[model samples]
Target chain A: MLKNVFVLALIVVLTLPGCTMEKKEKEQGYTARDELLGTEIIINIKNSKEAPGACDDIFERIKQIQGKMTVHNIESEIAILNANAGVKKVSLSQDTYNVLQEALTLSSLTGGAFDPTVGPLVKLWGFDSKNFGVPTDKEIQDKLNLVDYRQLQIEKSRDTFMAMLPRDGQAVDLGGIAKGYAGDEAKRILLSHGIKQGIINLGGNIVAVGTKEGGSAWRVGIQNPLAPRGTFLGILQLKDKAVVTSGGYERYFYENGNRYHHIIDPQTGFPSESDLLSVTIIANQSLMSDALSTGVFVMGLYKGLELMEELEGVEAIFVTRDKKVFITSGIRDIFQLIDGDFSYEQYK
Target chain B: MTVILVMNNINKWITGGLIVLAGLSFIVLYIYQGSQDHGQPVLVIYKNGALYQKLNLTKDLHKEFNVTSGGHFNTIEIKGKAVRIKEADCPRKICVHTGWLHKPGQIAVCMPNRLKISIEGRSDNVDDISF
Candidate 1:
């Protein structure tokens, strides 16, 4: 009897760890990181045998999109379009045309606050180069003349799509929207690979594909713009959604006692002087969140809040310069304010 | 009758010993589970998409090392539970400027050299951050 009891106890003790090991194997996750579109891209997928191959496919797709849309690459289609401005209508790839269509739609929706033709102003402000300086008022006024999104003409005839800038100086820069589009594309790739749980982070634009392991919502932190990177003002419980933030803190230069940021307002031709320091948008699609974050940041707090309330399935969190945090009604429950220094309020 | 009584006493002793043994094993399992750091953080370094090194941050130690790739080098320093890129030959020095990183999910990257250093642990409060 004693021998039988000892043997049974030993079996139970030994099998416990084995059971846990099997559970661990089932929850295995794979992560890969690469540099694409001039930023760090990290893709993490859980419990998928095709993760590595899927990540490769996703990166390849993003690189192909970058080749067509990046203004930094002279051979890119966007660069060619900029070069041939007012001279001829340049043919566009399907991907580029689709992204442009989204950009234009966002521009109209935001009432020109998120214009795609702000490239000349981006260059004149030295954001495209290492020389960061404050441009003169006259220079900004001249660049603003070329910053209109309406001047960009897109024509689609049956199978062919062509785009042209009606003026020589006008150019289109998709820097604000391309990363979000790439993130959306990555999520599609992950889903196609049977990866139900994943996180796609293109720089700071995040696309949470599904609930985390065990069906818990993924916790995504919102950056504290006033503090250094990695510090968060709050966390959002997200599943099958995208979050994109626009802030002047990302790129800026200090000249004398003033600071100039990179998000040039199409109307003012200057870094946005909006009362809010940062704006974050969350939606079902990364492309919408990405473009709307920029436009809302430039639109200021009240107007931006109004826009958020009007839009369905779109939520926003705005951090004002005075350290007031405001969230749209939709995200009031999901967003948890972690930082005590900032006061949180839900906009009516 | 004496033999029967002796056998009964022996069975009781055996049953008591078995209960004590099972109880001890359960206590040991509980301690083992408590000691396990399920979410212990780790510092991971990647060079050109391949994992270069992984260090257990729970260990108390101070160390510095140089990682060279393609004729370029970055000096990484680890102190206590934190890590940082102390120096690098890259022109921008963006990685070095990133400063110390101690929390899980924090990352510093040297894009020119294709080197990235990040803290990763299952115990992270947030999976990713949006800026």
Candidate 2:
């Protein structure tokens, strides 16, 4: 009887907190894992128990949602709807409808700066899987006729959309804003499932939820635009904040020693010619951060800061062609300029 | 007697497990800190252009490299082991203000006349690729 009692006590002692038993789980938890999203989508999330599975779940959801929304996939609802162009109405899933509605609203807010209807121009530039060489001015002009957000109508009441594209084939690609929106959704899903502290880095768009272990803010390093890799211009402390950087170096084909990137200006229908090398936007919303990073990069310095100041919670860091750093007032306090070539200038 | 014997063995095992865990934790901490360094060579700036500090792959501090007159303000060249900064004509001493490159991908710059000191490391295809 005494032996059994001692055994019971031993089990309790081993299972209790601060136990020296080797098999005992540590109070402090750490995890790291990779999540594959479709063919191209892969996101890594580091957290406690909810990490590995949550990351995988988020990627799976992204694939499922992308499959439904991608214009490239003929079987996708978006492609099928676009195939029957000049239609009266086409119904969409809630997720698709939500993304489109948000894109339209962002388009209005940025004054067509963040238009989803830019797909026509994207394809014309051959950035569409083919990445065909630059298009002629006349060809771009012909395609530009069908690339207006005002023409694309969204009826939120019925979750249906209608777009008026030319016969030459005007496509509406939500590629720019979709990834960010998906990141935001993935975070929301993770949080709902009791996973609090983590970061979702989708390409260059990063979202941090909650603080690190021991209640430390997540230290996020922004990449140096000119530097190749693992080189940071500075570090920012993100506490439940989403940061998205749009740079001239993210994607481009170099021919004859000249670099051509993915982010194209709608007005000229070519790569943006702003002095800014990259723009990183920090906000509570991932979609907004994503949308604004691209929009503000195209807006350049003056107008970009103006927009940053007008918005209550938006902060931006801009690196110009002259290697000068420009950041908004709010951003200056949070940003630590570690080793950039130039001092940071606050553009009113 | 049996209980006492078993208890002694259990206590020994517990202590052994704890020592093992403490050692493992220490090793883990060391690795984490080591990986974080990221292999950036350190370059410390000093007066006279003749005096400077250079840290190699092992990060062993080796101060005072031989300065050669390269016409530019203290130019630090990392050919094999030695690094030298050339002549500096600037009166403000801005080049001397920029410090060492401890992180793998970090770069220090003196923009007055375009002088760049950087740590060059192999690119690890990181997701975000932050500095």
Candidate 3:
């Protein structure tokens, strides 16, 4: 103890004069903030000469995506398709076709766990409106008939693109995958601006561009579902990847002590009833990880694990309701537990 | 001789018991530290999933405002550190039911109106942001 105290005192004495020495860092990259898609979007760059101009361009790109994809916007491509649902085939814009096509591919991969056609069910449950109420079994079943990706017909060519939903009651909402596309597009803009390293946080969809300044891997926190927001269960060390999580705590309603969230299961017309509380997906593209997070969440532990195994370039961390965390092989080495109570277990 | 053996056994049990107590206290301390909110609370309001405004909850007294978007209207009232949606034209009074927002990171969203309000702690110096 005496030797330790002596060393501590010596360190303090040696550092005392340096306390007044302040050095300001130049080339501190810009972080432009704006409200997009009903969430705060922050774009941070490591080093930049034209901070304002680059940030303006990044925000502009996000705005364009939001305008084209937002379902509520009457002039948006999605709105046009939704307006013509079950009526006629409507030609889609280039961006809409790509996002829709990606959603379709993801839907097929997850077996409809993450569907774009659940709009009708989302509306019936009043998740789309302020008239939120519980829906009857008959009501859910009726809407479920319209909520099939198979019924969402797609026709495309080099110059023109069109899509049609089978029935009039059916609708399409791309809330799940659009943000991922936004993150990916923003990354493109940042790279074009000569941003070698940066962080794009579009709400919870975090996309790390390259590595951090000085060549350190980005450390991302995973939300603790059972606790308040911003409280994390652990950290994920990643480089040039997007980390997205899907959980009930972000957006949900509690009625009679039962929690109902926006992620409706395509099989059932209600909030998914699964043993899992949250699922975090990491991948090269934010769109893939964002959509897969929800897809895996609805698929639950076993089937979700199967989905992760089949897909390449994808890693997942599944947190169950009982506070157990299961990690995919890719994340095993990089996953660091912040909360001691939660154990990271591997399952075959 | 038997008494001496019993005393020695009791001494061994005490040492083990002290180690166990230390372990339990360490766990409790860790939990207590994790539960603390490190920074000052700020109110952040979102519309259509984008941040519309951010206000310091501890300053400037009361601030009342109306958010109008796409023909939908919701009136927000902030008194001191608590905030709530006073009135909304949406069908269900879910936002109102959300009550007050006092704790940092607690969120109240009126999805129908495309309005969301959340309290942010000023001192949450996290290197990574979670979705």
Candidate 4:
């Protein structure tokens, strides 16, 4: 009896310190939010305002990236590439070259399921301009012919790089990967600016700098695919990782009781007919997570699962239209389902 | 003596079981406490990513306000718990189409006008951004 009491007392004593330790490490971090990169940018820093100019420097880098990669910007490198399609190879900065290369790799990895060259299809569907109009069958077919990631060719020189779009009117859209790149840059800038721990939320792309206060895992809510932005089906307790979800609900239009979303399929030249409502990917790098989320989202569940299985250091949580949650084996313990309506089926 | 020993064993068993049960309940309670909603909903408006205004949604009020950013004006309407963009000078009218923002975590963005309205912290921070 005495021994049992001692053991119980020991356990209590051991566990009691953690609560106070957590309280001691608690720091009222700074939070700043901005509307840049066509998304909300929320930054949280624990304990100090060591670098007040860090945000300005970080946002400047983001804007520079946006200006470089956006096809909309006439002076942007991407716009120059689109202009020279089938005419000439446009010179690209190292940043543009690297992102384009990574995008091409992800495109092949997902079997063209997520194509950067799906710009024509995206435009025809009226998503880029948000006109909310459907393209004619002939128009889709014509655009589909031009929607090939393979056709975006690259040639590297000593100092600079050049890229060619094989067909005229073919364009490359870095929407899928640019934000992730921007997020990583933000992380680098924050670290350089003397901020030890932070959370960089560039719209949907979340790059957790370090663990929350007291070395506890940050509780990041997984947005419910069917509900509003803040409504979540689950919470991912994570530290020092990027959690990105590409949902069919992000941009959609309802016409005649039918919901048409913005994730255009490279094959069908329309929105992907995937049964999935959202795909949340957890990865070490924000860029890969950003690209893979879109790729897995476009690939649908089966192929997406197969791809994730082959890849190393990546886990995914797929939410279907019926609200059934399917998570990879890795995230089982890490992901907690908060919403009782959504059920997570354990895959064999 | 034998009866006394038996009673002590029973006492130990019950106490051990109760300790384990208490430990389990504490863990469960800790987790439950972590995800609980923090407070009532607050309507937060952002212009160019900065907090422009924060209004309590529970307040019984109906007012339409215009936020001008970079020469663009977005007319925002807040009535009770529901808030929305009633009108905007922007061409897309996407903010108007965002319909109504009632629930916590819902956000309506007027991209061209650089205006965004979001319901502020009533619960846990976003763990995994779904969209």
Q: What is the TM-score of each predicted model, taking all chains together?
A: 0.84, 0.68, 0.75, 0.82
Q: What does candidate 4's lDDT look like per residue over A102-182, in tens digits?
A: 999999998898899998777777777757677789998998999888888987979889899988989888888999999
The candidates' interface RMSDs, in order, read: 4.9, 12.0, 10.4, 5.8
lDDT of 3 by residue, B68-120 (tens): 99998988899898788888887655676667767665666676688888887
* Docking quality class, candidate 1: acceptable
CAPRI band for model 4: acceptable
Q: Specify the poorest-scoring 10-residue window by lDDT in model 2 chain B.
A: B122-131
Q: Please say which candidate is ahead in DockQ: 3 or 4.
A: 4
True contacts kept of each: 0.51, 0.19, 0.37, 0.48
lDDT of 3 by residue, A1-348 (tens): 354456555545544433322222344566778878766788877555766777898889888988988876899888888888868999988888988899999999999999999888888987765567788899999999888897888889888998888688788988889889999998888888777688889888899989976788988888877755556788888899999999876677667777678889999888999889999999999999988998899999999998897789999999998889998887778988878878877688
Candidate 1 lDDT by residue in tens digits, A1-348: 677567667756754764575577677678888889888888888746688899999999999989999999999999999999989999998888888999999999899999999999999987776666788999989889988888898888888989999888889999889998898899988888888888998988999999988898999999988755677889999999999999997777667868788898999999999999899999999999999999999999999999988999999999999999999888878999988999976566
Task: Rank all candidate structures by their TM-score, best first, as comma-separated numbers.
Answer: 1, 4, 3, 2
Interface RMSD (Å) of model 2?
12.0
Q: Which predicted model would earn the best lDDT?
A: 1
Report per-prediction Cα RMSD to one decimal.
Answer: 4.5, 13.1, 12.2, 7.4
For model 1, the superposed segments whose C-alpha errors exceed 4 Å read A1-22, B1-102, B110-115, B119-123
Runs with alpha carbons beyond 4 Å of true place in candidate 3: A1-29, B1-125
Give the worst 10-residue stretch by lDDT in candidate 1 chain B: B30-39
- Model 4 scores a C-alpha lDDT of 0.82
Candidate 1 iRMSD in angstroms: 4.9
Mind giving the per-residue lDDT tens digits that candidate 2 earns over B1-131?
A: 99989987887676666556656666665675577555455444433212243445443445443333345455454444323333345333333433334444454434333444545444333324331
